[model samples]
Target: MAKPLVKRAIRGATVNTGSRRFNLPEREADGDWLDAQGEIDGAPAPLRTSVTVETPRTIITRNSSPDVFFDRSINPYRGCEHGCIYCFARPTHAYHDLSPGLDFESRLFAKPQAAELLRAELRKPGYVVAPIALGTNTDPYQPIERDWRITRAIIEVLAETRHPLTITTKSDRVTRDIDLLSAMAAEGLAGVAMSITSLDPTIAATIEPRAPHPERRLRAVRMLADAGIPVYVSIAPVIPSITDHELEHLVERAAEAGAKSCFFIPVRLPHEVAPLFRAWLDAHFPDRAGKVMAIIQSLRGGRDNDPDFFTRMQGAGPWAELMRTRFRIACRKHGLGNRGAPLRTDLFRPPAGPQGELF
Candidate 1:
């Protein structure tokens, strides 16, 4: 029999772990490596993040989901390093034959050609302009973006083409692009949604390990608002028995940070996320893990998740109703009702061809 992979904690990571398959002991039809590891190991070194370039021929992804706000989106990267255990997008990595656990965090992919491809797509003769949603799948501004600059490059392309854009991210690093964003906002071409799940540092750290601190996110919200850019605060994945309690307080904070509005989603455990979340709760909040999951199940129509369109975003059942009610009340009290003005698509123009720079 093989040993179960050890559960360990990595700083800035929810669960310093890998998926079942990735963690499997190296089977050599022999036990030499396992014995050798035991002899020399005190504790294994922490996993390091690696980035790979993904060259995709296209950049914009179109969708027809009635529930989502936008029809077109761009994901500059695959596999987020933020390692939020509750992330609904975790299962995406499985498509690449990568683990949805720690491997999803440490093994990352960047689309350096994103900006160029976006330009090409925009130049297509029949291209129709709509607000391009950024960071819809994996965060566009994940850590590796500092060196890769794919997100910024994509933004530059959007800004140059006069395309309307909506960005959602938790990293304060978005502030680094304020110059471009502010320029677009002035033209009614850009808006941003900053996701801040919890105000408590400890909770935030554990849930979104590599994400920017809550305070930093708040500051970024303020910065965007001050720049005359529309910014909304997202209290996403409101986990029962954990982050759910912070709801009203978070709404108040968002209002104080100058957010135009606020919205939240009850945690959704779609696909592989349910097991990962269950393991996370067991490891971090063992005492109430059962209670947490019970409430979640009740909200999820007696299952780990409710995939039904409208219900999936806000959840269902009494618990779900209560959460929505609380959110509405809080928003009303804090006067955060604005959803920001509609973005203008009229300003869009195709990228000025390959030598767009020579102008």
Candidate 2:
């Protein structure tokens, strides 16, 4: 009989602890212990269990960054388990003593007090009314949201106050709040952008492991549209040499699905995301790695990434020009709106409160 394969948990080495470490191991082929060691014997490393934590903090982060479209945003959770290698938000995990690679997708933090904090912030005297952006940092509708319901609670507060809000997500789970969203849309208080990276299921599975399937996202777009909500199709971070070819096709499909507007952005590899993306490419598509990066650099002014304002979102150079031209042509061909039409902000009405309340 063949021996069973042993599985072990991998952990980071402690500071100044030599090259030796300890880990528990078990068989892979069968649920049995093969060996136990307190010290390293030049064997493989072990894997660790995923840890989830709950955090209490104020919601509604204010941002003055000129690049962002919104002045304020809300994120119900930290650390996305969707595990997209190209996620620019991955670096945030380092602040929590976690790896931006595997740990980013496993370790998660949920804000249970988000609704209360939002209510308090809204009730403040000086709070200004603007369209609050949701899922700006981490997706508010991630799988854990099913139980936390933090996103829903925040939405409830916003709805009660008639605050204008916008949501961007890659999950079909957002459909659960369609009734509220549709009502808000009727009052010009809400809009949604469904991010569809690729129509190919295989590529989607590899790039966004835990996100809803592409077909499902398309269905979500249709549902939102049918509910009288403004729906936009976002083909974000269009990976060059990879999913770039699918731009026009994706736009056509989204248009058919009732999306009124379409947008696309060249890929970005900011911070630690660069290394993580490179690792993922090497693991999944080694043969096309160099070609893929080469195309990205072409768009990014001969660099791995371009962080310049105005240029970052749309890139420069010939490759950038080609992508822009293609997108424009696609939008025209499909009758999609030129760019996302700006949501109404002038119509916002602050929640009713005391006469002396701060504005």
Candidate 3:
């Protein structure tokens, strides 16, 4: 008989460290263990993140989800390192036979050829121009972007073609591309939305471990708006008992920082995310765990998630209605949610070449 796999938990990591659930033959760890150095430990070791590069045949992903604003989006990377406990994207890691827990954040994949693939797709005869969205699944400006520069390269291609584009991210690193985006915005071809969940640094750190601080995101909004780029604030996945209280404050502050528009979504715990969020609540807000879940279920139709179209983004029930009311009132007072110039797809020019240029 084969020996069962042993899994050890890593401290200070958002996801619980353990073997992936997808692994087969049903593995279990033995309680008995031996220390290599005979029981000499101060603090638990931290989990190390590893990245793999993939050369995908295609870059643009087509989505027909009515809830999403865009028809197509590009994800330059997979498995975000930001490690937000409530991230809806975590479950995607399961497709790789990796645990949606720690592995979702620690084990990452980058598409180094994203720019090349995008250019090719854009040059195709049947290609149509629309605002291509970045950071839909994984943040294009995550920490590793500094090294890979893949997202920047992709933007360069769009700039060359004068294509309309939208970027959503939690990192201020998007500021680095201001030179490119600002020029595109000049022609009504670019816009950006920065996601900020909480104004409290302590709470921000606990939830979104590696994302830019809320203040930094606000600063980026100011920088982008000052540069002529349309900047919007996304106060997304507002946890009922935790971050929801800051709804009015977040939108008002973002408007003060030059965010012309704002939108928010109630927290949704789909599949594996439910347990992960529950674990986080137990560790951080044990006192309110039951209450929080109870409120969330009320919004999700007595379930952890409501995946229906239109209704999924926002939920039902009085609590959801109350949150929406607060957001609307705040937006009205702050002069936000005023959708201005639309991104222009008419300016796009197909690249001329047999092989797509790598920008």
Candidate 4:
């Protein structure tokens, strides 16, 4: 009387489940099965990615976090396809009644009217111009950007108004918008930061299954810098004993490839990220899992994370200090951290429309 439930397995995919709990009272499948078909033809069906559309009334999201560099941001998408196990944004998927684990990667949401809403917001007479940030909440240039193009549309609007913007992403697809970003950079209106976690291709493939290879990201830094766009390389969430070993090498390679600035954040295991990261460690580095978590806890003040405003980004105590010292020395040795130019806001001109056009 009911349709058969089929399960699919995708190579290189990280998350394992298909559905999750919801806030509302609803029926759910229990894990009690008697006898079931395990496989059909000795191979599993391919898991296909799915996307949903969200039309919101506004586009600009402003926050007042002391640790962050930007106050306002725009996320064209609601989930990242990269499937990094340590992503801090993963838990947000729980608000949608989805698993922060698998659904955060396979089930996605896109804002088709993001550019239109941004244009409307910018055209308000009382609006003030500042550098709008992208890829802050969820990466804007994930694989889906090739089809949805919401991020590109938003950039087009910003380019038209000469509005300042900054982007952070792990995908090389950003190079596709070089023409738009370069023109804005020429006027001091745009900049970009690329995240490179590890130089070992094996580690990278296991941790960031769908993200661009580390080398490709390095090449992207060079490409953007060569085109006059200021580029910063981030060695974010330095996993203890996993990715931390490549700290100096990562910064050195990025600097050689044209990065003018660098930033690093020691791993933070907030909320659901902790269990997910533990599972990842058990799967990838079972032998060293306990040691790795112990070191992370030492940096986190005997806990999995430190949520304090000032200490959250950089952590605290001696272990954190060691990372800071290492990062500072490496950055200095590579001739980085001298980029001081700020994105200009004086060049912004609102679109001609009923919201702001001259009478």
Candidate 5:
């Protein structure tokens, strides 16, 4: 009489499970909207992604976490369309009364006024000139970006003001703004990090259903590097059994593509992301699901996640040590040192308006 485990993937338009309950792990709870809707009664209707305008009063977000690198960041979008099952940002959607499962990918919010808001903040009399990070919460170049162009507009403002900026993304689309980024790099005002989790296309597709292909991302690194932009390759959220095996090969590939540095983090499963990732493992790698979680726990100090300041970013224990050792060896083998230079705050010029106009 019990419902079966889920087979729903991160991306799909329809579902058909006759005479059985579709046990979506993240939404199986009693108060979940998936169960409340009961829309799966017949042939599942097509699920489409929707974007809503988010008109927040401000744009720059301040961070004080010692573990985090940047003090201020900006998120042009709320929910990511990349659909990476291991995204730590997934839990943020709960504030909007939305599921971190399907809704996080399908229902999105964009700040169309991000550029204008950023200019106003920059024009403030006491504003600081530290580098602003993009793609910290959600990928700025996610698929919807092609049409929205909000990220582009923000970059335009940064370039116009000669503000220092750093970008992290998984899309080759970053190359589309090579003109701005390369110009910024000339003044030592910009840097970029491209995350390449897996070299095998199948694994990349399974985990990040909507992200650009691994090969394309590598090529993007090449293009960015060739443009004189400092390129750092990040093997972020390294899943234990799923992606750990590719750590060395991914490093090699990234180095071949002209990465100036390489780094990695063990997977993080805070809040709702844990259940969703577990369900994804059940659906995709049923044979190795238990083993994966076990190793993750070992790295995370016997819990599914460790939210401590320093320990969260770099896991502890024997497993974490082994990963660090391996990563060190790989970076050495590929001649990729942690060499990304700090962006130049000295070159920053405030936007030409308001409080900054007379400066």
Candidate 6:
């Protein structure tokens, strides 16, 4: 029998069969899936339900934009296993003819050449070393990192080159790199930010699915601090009505756990993510979905999302101000404020190589 079509929520794509959802075979397949019309379907049609990991050639990606803080970053993996429903990176999977929902989580990619590519880039002369951010777009320390060790390899390259770097992740697996991170910290070359969405594990499981428990992330903060690395707690994509109540407590706990600073951003639902997030909210938190969206709209200037630069990271309007006020009060109460030292960029050493060379 021909394989059944998988039911998913990708835009404009649907599985009309009411009786069953598609199931993968016991093993993975290498080729793409074709629809009834013989055209390539954007949703992933995995032959097996189990995880498939693949590697790409290049790693270091350079971006010149006004909105983001860092100009360069490296993502060792393509699709994250953490399976956060609100992941903005989900839309990226559509480029590979895959769904931004479940497929984005199960169908994974890693760059085994990441360390080599990073070394090649760093070796280029005149490459002004700035803090290269990891886990900027996707969580580098996601579950697969344990097996692939791609992230660890990338960090090893950075450490050897004395390249200043910053990492943001929600997993305690970051602790595994503590020795390297600690050594770099001594030279003002590294920093880490742990994303803590909610203090409640139940909410975390439903929203983030595969991420580590909240308390484990807090413990990671302590571990990194104990290792002498600067650690910050990021309570990002702060979903109103749901996780908003934990703002004060979250910051308080992170500070208690040795987090040097705390930051947060209101939830963002751009492009295909808006619908995916809505479906998830409806499925898991039906009672609070309406209220949550309303508060999000309030912060977003009456829209589902605001793409404007400064306002995008930090929302606009009264609700945004209220969130800022709460965060400020909490930080002040916990003694985490401007007095905390800023990440050092002065120690950046140009990656050694031929001037203006592009790999």
Give the clash total for candidate 2.
Answer: 8
lDDT for each residue of candidate 4 in 252-351, tens digit (9 for 90 to 100)? 9988999888899998888777877886777678999999999989987898888888788898888889988999999999888755498999998988
CA lDDT of each prediction against the hidden true structure: 0.86, 0.78, 0.85, 0.84, 0.86, 0.78
Residue 38 of model 6 has an lDDT of: 44
Give the residue spans of candidate 4 off by over 4 A: 1-44, 354-359
Candidate 2 has an lDDT of 0.78
lDDT of 6 by residue, 1-359 (tens): 45543443322112211111222222222334544324555555432324445555556688987877688899988877787877888777766666666667777777777887787777666677688899988899988889889899988888877788899999999999999999999988889999999989888877786789998999999999999999999899799988889999998998899998988999998766777777677667789889989988888889888888889899998989999999999999999864235456665554555454455
Tens digits of per-residue lDDT for model 3 on 208-326?
88888899999999999999999999889899889998999998899899998999999988777887788788777899999999999999999999989887899999999999999
Q: With candidate 3 superimposed using the best TM-score fit, by how many Å does residue 236's alpha carbon deviate from the native?
A: 0.4
Which residue segments of model 6 deviate by more than 4 Å? 1-57, 338-359
Candidate 3 TM-score to native = 0.91
Q: Give me the displacement of residue 3 in model 5, in angstroms.
A: 4.2
Better of 1 and 2 by TM-score: 1
The true-versus-predicted C-alpha distance at residue 123 of model 1, in Å, is 0.3
User: TM-score per candidate, in order?
Assistant: 0.92, 0.84, 0.91, 0.90, 0.90, 0.83
For model 2, the stretches where C-alpha displacement exceeds 4 angstroms are 1-56, 339-341, 344-359
Q: What lDDT tens digits, residue by residue, belong to model 1 across residues 1-359?
A: 75434444543333433345444322121245445565776455667889888898898999998889999999999999898888888878877767677778888988888888888888889988899999899998888888888899989989988999999999999999999999999999999999999999999988888898999999999999999899999899899999999999999999999999998989998877887788788778999999999999999989999999888897888999999999999999999995888999998878777576688
Better of 2 and 3 by lDDT: 3
Candidate 5 lDDT, tens digit per residue, 1-359?
Answer: 54444334447211121111222334442334445445644323445789999999999999999988899999999988888888898778877767777778889999999999999998889887999999999999999999999999999999999999999999999999999999999999999999889988898888898899999999999999999999999899899988998989988998999999898999998877777787788778999999999999998889999999989999999989999999999999999998577888887777788544567
How many Å off is the CA of 176 in candidate 2? 0.5
After TM-score superposition, the amount by which residue 332's alpha carbon in candidate 3 deviates from its true location, in angstroms, is 0.4
